[model samples]
Target: MKILTNLFSVIASILLSASIAAAALDPVSINLRSDEKNPASPVMGDHLQFWSTITNTGTSPIEGLVAWISLVEIDPGNEQPVDLEDWSAHKAVTGASLKPGETLRTDWPMRLIKGGDYRVVVSVTDRGGRQVYTGPTIQFHVRQKPVLQAGRVLPVAAGIPLLFIGLIIFNNTRRRHGNGRL
Candidate 1:
C-alpha cells in the first residue's frame, strides 16, 4: 500500500511539473483583426492587410516579438503558398521591454498572393532571450487565381504525370544500357 501511494504521488508531481513547464513556455494573449468584415477571396498578386495585438502574460519582460503567416492551398491537398516573397515578417522594435501586465499592439500589414487556407503563428521572447509565449496558429483562406486557371494550356496538376514519365524513361534507358539490351 505504501509503494502504491508513493507511485501515485510521484505521478501526480510529474504531471504538475509538466503542466507548469508548458505554461511557462509561452504564456501570451493575442487578439488579431482585419479591415475587411466579410471573408474575401485572394488571387495572385494581392495585398492582404492585417492587425495584431500581443500581450505578455508571463512575469518577465518581452524583448521582441515575431509573427509569421502562411497560406496553403485547400483544393486537392493542402498545398503550400507560391511566389511568397515574405512568409515571415517581424515588427521592428529594439530594446523594447514590456513589463508584466503590459501589452504591445501593432498595425501589422502583409501581402498575400496565394490560393488556400493559411495558418499564422506569433511568438514573443523575453529580455533573457527565452521564448515566453507562442500564440496559437491562426487560419485564413484565399481564393483561387482565376486568370491562371483559365489561361492554363497545361494543367499544373499535370506536372506530376510529366515528372513520372521522365523518371520512367530515364530508368528504362539506364536499365537497357546496364543489361547490354540497348
Candidate 2:
C-alpha cells in the first residue's frame, strides 16, 4: 500500500508539471488591419500598407516566430491565391520574439495589382511547428479604374480630326467669299 501511494504521487506531480509547461507555451494571438481608416477599398494601381499586431499571451517568451501575409481572390469564377512576389517587396518577417503580454506590430506594404475581391490574412508560426496563429480575414474589393477606356477614347479620337477639318473648310470658304484677303 505504501508503494502504490508513492507511485500515484509521482505520477500526479509529473502530470502537473506537464500542464504548467503546456500553459506557458500557449500560442499567441494576432490581429491584422490596414493603417488606412477608410474601408479597405483600394483601386487598382493603388499602393497600401497593412499592420499586423502579434501579442504573446503565454507566460513564457516566444522566439523564432515567422509572420507573412496571404492574399486570395474571392471573385466569382476567379478565385485563386495571389503571389506576393509582384505585390510586395518584403514578404515575410522572421526571427521575431515576444515576451509575455508583449505586442509586436509588423508592416506589410503592397501594391494593388489586379481588380478583384481579395481576402488578406496574416499568419504566424514557430520554427518548432508547435502552434500556428492566424489573424482575422480582411476582405477588400479592388475597384477597376480604366485610365483609357476604348469606349470613351474612340469618340474623342474621331472628333478631334473632324474638328480640324471643319475649321479648315470654314477658313477656305471665308477666304473664297471675302476676296481672298482680310
Candidate 3:
C-alpha cells in the first residue's frame, strides 16, 4: 500500500506540471494600425496602407505563424469582406516564427475602389493550433472626390489676381516711400 501511494503521488505531480507548462503557452497579442504614422484621409481610387504588429507574450516561442489583414465595407450598408486574392495590387507580409517576448510587424497595401466607411482587421495564428490572436478593428472613412463647381472655383480663381495686385501695390508704395521712387 505504501508503494502504491507513492507511485500515485508521483504521477499526479507529473500531470500537474505538464498542465502548468501547457497553460504557460498562451496566445500572442496583436495590434493593428491604419496609417497611424502618416495619416491620410483617402478618397476613391486612392491607395491605403495598413500596419500590424504581433507580439509573443507567452513563455514559449511560436512557429509557423501566419499574419493577415482584412478589409470590409461597413457603412453605406454593410458589404461582404473584400477578397484580397482578387486585388491585383494588394500585398501582405507573413512570418515564420516569433520568439517569446519578440515582436513582428507586417504591412498591407490596398487600393480603395469605392468611397464609404470601412474597417481593417489583423489576425495571427500558429501552426500547432495552440494559439491565435486578433487585433482590434480600425474604422476609417473614404470620401468621394469633391465635385468641381463654378461657384467654388471662380472665387478662388478671382482671388488669386486680386492677391497678386495687392502685393504689387504694397511693394510699389514701400519702394516709393523708402527710396523716393515709384
Candidate 4:
C-alpha cells in the first residue's frame, strides 16, 4: 500500500510539472492599442479603430490562432458589456500560422453608439480553445452628443427682432413726416 501511494504521488507531480512546462512553452504574445492612446472624451457617433498585434516569441511556429476584440462599458452605475455585432464588422481575425518572431496585425473599426465610460481589450485563443491570451486594457469615455434646437426656434427668434427693428425705423420715418404714432 505504501509503494502504491508513493507511485501515485510521483505520477501526479510529473503530470503537474509537464502541464506547467507546456504553458511556459506557449509562443504567442499579443498587444492591443487604439489610434488614440486615451481618447479625450470621444462623443457618441464617433468612430474609433483598434489594432491587435500577435507575435510568436518562441522558437516554434504557432498555428490555428484566433483573435478578437471586446468592448465593455464601465460607466458608474451603468457598467455592462457591449454587443459588437453592429458596432464592429471586423471583430475577429484568424491566423493559419505564425513563424518564430513573426507578427500578425488585425484592425478593428468600431462606431460609438452610446455614451459611457468604456474599456477595450484584445484576446487570442488557440484553435482548440485550450489557451487564451489577453492584451492590456484600453480605457476611454464617450460623451453624449449635444442636442441643438436652433432649427425649431431660430426663425421665430430672428423674425421677432427684425420685425421690431423695422417697426422702430418706420415709426422714426413717420415722425419726421408729421405722423409720430408708433
The prediction achieving the highest lDDT against the true structure is 2
Ranked candidates, highest lDDT first: 2, 4, 3, 1
lDDT of 2 by residue, 74-171 (tens): 99998999998999997898998888889989988888888889999998887866767778898888899887999999999999999999999999
Model 3 RMSD in angstroms: 16.2
What local lDDT score does residue 58 receive in model 1, on the 0 to 100 scale? 70
lDDT of 1 by residue, 1-182 (tens): 99999999999999999988977655577666665843476654576565666776778766555444333444457455433356425443345567677877765555665556776544555456654355565566767667645347466578879999999999999998999954
Model 1 has an lDDT value of: 0.62
Off by over 4 Å in 1: 1-27, 36-39, 64-94, 148-182
Please provide TM-scores, in order, for all candidate models, with all chains considered together: 0.52, 0.66, 0.59, 0.65
Q: Top TM-score: which candidate number? A: 2
**Model 2 misplaced regions, further than 4 Å:** 1-26, 37-40, 150-182
Better of 1 and 3 by TM-score: 3
Q: Tell me how far candidate 1 lies from the true structure as C-alpha RMSD in angstroms.
A: 13.0
Please, what are the lDDT tens digits per residue for candidate 3 over residues 1-182? 99999999999999999986864555577888777553478787677777788888878888888887777877755777876664325444445788888999777777777778878888778778755566889888888876688899999999999999999999999988989753
* Tens-digit per-residue lDDT, 1-182, candidate 4: 99999999999999999987976676777788887653566888878988888888779767788888999989888888899988888888875678899999888898888888889999887675587888889888889986668887899999999999999999988788875443
Q: In model 4, what is the error at residue 166, expressed in angstroms?
A: 25
The reply for model 4, stretches above 4 Å from the true place, is: 1-26, 36-39, 147-150, 153-182
Clashes of each: 2, 0, 0, 0
149 in model 2: Cα distance from truth in Å?
3.8
